[model samples]
Target: MRTVESRNWYEKSFGEDYLLVYKHRNQHEADRFVQRVIEWLELPSGSRILDLCCGAGRHALGLANAGYRVTGVDLSSVLLQKAKEADSSGCVRWVEADMRALPQDGTLTNSFDAVVNLFTSFGYFETDREQLDVLKQIWMALKPGGRFVLDVLNAGYVQDHLVPFSQRKENGVVISESRVIQNGFVIKEIKVEEGGSRPRFYTERVKLYSPQDMENMLKETGFLLDVMSGSYDGEAYDERRSPRMIMLGHRNL
Candidate 1:
């Protein structure tokens, strides 16, 4: 008998140390990236947008600052609180929830004009059914003709350029990351060492989905493909060279 693999790594992985681990993420860059996305997708001013898996509300706040109504949803309470604290003006609504099952209340279901799942937010589940359920949730959350931006790592690029191990020191901690591609998943083991504290380890595993794989999934989830880009600058997608596979699409009317 086949059973579902437990997929709680994400629930445990995102914590205070994650902020230090992803410290390189820049706000100016997020602003510019979302600006380009707005222009590329032609999202109207004040349109409702759902930032799925919007960790710390970077791009979500970016979109809100650009005059859009934004809802930032993430699973991490630590990150969500950070996002809320940063949003002193209450410009963005922060929701702590898993992507696989979004709020079904009138507040979210079929209420968004667009949805953005940035930073490889997809491909976390252990099975295809669970992954597809996330897409269905995203689809259900959008209004007809709502745009979606799914930014994910390019599988081919990662396979071709997999760095097996790396270590770095930042903010009084030693962070070591080990990467491997196994069982159609990109697995990352992160270890953090701090002063006088035992080393803490966290693991992140994302399914490796190629461009074609995304296309099929999106179509299956009732999304109509619009544009596929390699970068935030709107470069064309190339399987071998693109660092990111950014899929831009829309839910059918």
Candidate 2:
């Protein structure tokens, strides 16, 4: 149900070597995704938000700009550094830590009004239990009646449109891709060939979950289902056409 082993490719690949790739391309896309999450959560100003696995502070920084006290936690020092560089307001409090074993700083125990696990972040753990534990921890991190928002990929759609391999070049960067295999995991291998340099390759393998699987996990973690949307514009979830599986869950008071 979750990823295992020390297979976090982003920690090494997303640093100095590939920061430009992430900053220029992925960051902007992530910003657009965050905007959707913010709109869906609809929390009032001055809310405290915890962004679990806050890669490059996309949503975290955006939330801060929108007037939320944001604490972003991630395992990648390189990404966090980029996040810090892009973080001009100093409004984001970045912490380098694991999502499962959040630091016992006494600062995050039931401290946030909302927690966001965006960009298909829930399935990168080592095992099903570990993945569930991450959800449980998130449940524990929220105040009574707080909300959790997730932007997940539609596994079904991915399988339907499975592309064995592909490539594209942008901003002097050549990106290769591959995907196939399901239920157990979705292996997306992206190879970035930077112009005037050797090609660097990174693979991301994340466990895949169906809507039922996600619903069951959220219920097991004590979160009440709120709404499920297919896209960022508050569109209804359509299995055939939607580009993403965007859903929001709430922790009952």
Candidate 1: give the clashing pairs.
none
Worst 10-residue lDDT window for candidate 2 reads 1-10
Off by over 4 Å in 2: 1-10, 17-32, 195-198
TM-score of each: 0.96, 0.88
Q: Mind giving the per-residue lDDT tens digits that candidate 1 earns over 58-121?
A: 9999999999999999999999998998899999989999899887678999999999999889
Error of 1 at 13 (Å): 0.9
**Runs in model 1 lying further than 4 Å from the true structure:** 1-7
Clashes of each: 0, 3
As for model 2, its CA RMSD to the true structure in angstroms is 3.8
Question: Which residue pairs show collisions in model 2?
Answer: 3-125, 3-126, 4-126
Q: For model 1, what is the alpha-carbon lDDT of residue 127? A: 98
> lDDT tens digits, residues 1-253, model 2?
2244374664555566455545454656777776777787888899999999887888788888878999999888888988898898688999998788888778888999999988667787558898888888798889999998887888777778878998766676777777767557888776677767766767677787788898998888889988999876778988767767877889877
